[model samples]
Target: MSLSLRPARRDDAALILAFVRELADYEKLRHEVEAELADIERDLFGSNPRVFCDIAEWDGAPAGFALWFYNYSTFRGRHGIFLEDIFVRPAFRSRGIATALMRALAQRCVTEKLGRFEWNVLDWNAPAIRFYRSVGAIPLDAWTTQRVDGEALERLAAG
Candidate 1:
């Protein structure tokens, strides 16, 4: 099984979208996926992209992807990479694909001198948690994640 990682290209919009939906399905959040291919193309291939993606292929076929963006940490006083999503197809899991994808991001952090590489995983995802721990990722259990979206997000903005 030959595995390789490559930065996502403009023509990969549909593939990326498919991966996103597949991931959403795995996370049981498919109903929340409102993003369209145009949105993905605009955000990822736009002149000034705010987000980026990397595609992982196993034997020349799409196997997984990692989507991320730059974030800042006031205390660290430097930029860090925030991984929005990392997903490997079910058939491709446990094949080191996710590790490779993460390692690629970690390498970017080292090469760019970024402060940190971070991401969120659901509490119920024990397997993912174990995999993350094996890679030396420690959960910030002291912190809780918060979000405002959909109608509430619009109302908050209007306020």
Candidate 2:
């Protein structure tokens, strides 16, 4: 199967949203999909866009995508790329699509001299964990990921 990767465009909002919902469904958190295409379109294509994405095509059809953003690394004293999401459709799994998508990001890091590439994986997702390890990523077991959301986040911001 022929596969191609390219930067996402404003016209891809609907496809991206569909892939995101597929991801949420796979993770059994479909209810958490509160985002709309309008929000994605604005955030991805606005004058001061907050994030960026790349799309993967398998045999000229949308097969997967990777959304990412740049972040500052105080320790490295340089910026890094944080992969927010990477998903390959079930029919396209094990066909090297995910690897190609990640390589696109890694190549960007090397070409741009980004400090690092970082992302989080669910603890229970063994297949993804194994795939990540095969690609030279080490598990950051020493660090715990944290977040503030919904009401607590709002209250904290107000205080």
Candidate 3:
């Protein structure tokens, strides 16, 4: 099986959305998928896009994707790549696509002298945790992730 990765192009917006939805579904968070095709197109294919994506193709067929963006680190005094999402279809598992995607992004970080490469995995996802551990990722167990969105975000903004 020939597996290759390419930078996502404008025409791949729909495929990217599909991957997002599939990933959300697999995570049992499909209800959290608020992004539509237009959103994907505008954000990922718009003028001066900030976020970026990479597509993994196996034998010329789409198999998975990795979405990421640059984030600043005040301590490191440099930028890092924050991987927002990485998913490989169930059919594509055990093929090293996920690892390859991570490796590719890590390589980019190294090449660009990025301070770090980071991503979050659900605590309950044993398989994902194991995979990440295998990749030399250590959990910041003392650091808790915080978020505010929807009504909470609106309230905070209104304040």
Candidate 4:
């Protein structure tokens, strides 16, 4: 079972979108996904692209992916990685695809001297929580996530 990780190619837009939807479904947040294929292609492959994705393959067949981007840390005075999405198909579970993807990103952080690597997981995802804990990840229980979007986002903009 040869598993490898590679940077996503322009042709991987569809695969990336599929993974996004699948992950959203898993998190029970499918209704919040407003992304389209064109959005994936344009945002990931367009000029001056800010976000990026890494594809994981098992024996030359795509099995999973990790999408991430750089985020600024005002206190740290440096940039860090924010993993937007990570997913592996049901058939690919227990194959270390997820671990490999995480390792690759962590390696990137080390190599680039990035300040940190971060991602959010649903609180009720026990399995995911266990996996993350096994990876030496800590839960920031003191911090609460906040979001302002849709009508609230529009109102904020107008104000």
Best by TM-score: 3
TM-score of model 3 vs. true structure: 0.98
Give candidate 4's root-mean-square deviation (CA, Å).
Answer: 0.9
**lDDT per model vs. reference:** 0.95, 0.93, 0.95, 0.93
Positional deviation of residue 15's Cα in model 2 after best superposition, in angstroms: 0.2
Across residues 49-144, which tens digit of lDDT does each residue of candidate 1 receive? 999999999999999999999999999999999999999999889999999999999999999999999999999999889999988999998999
lDDT by residue for model 2 (30-113), tens: 998999999999999888897999999988999999999999899998899999999999999999999998999999999999
* Model 1 TM: 0.96
Q: Per-residue lDDT of 37-156 in model 3, one digit per residue for the tens?
A: 999999989999999999999999999999999999999999999999999999999899999999999999999999999989898899989999888999989998999998999999
Indicate whether candidate 2 or candidate 3 has the larger TM-score.
3
lDDT of 1: 0.95
TM-scores for every predicted model: 0.96, 0.97, 0.98, 0.97
What tens-digit string does per-residue lDDT give for candidate 4 at 8-52? 989999899899999999999999999999999898999999999
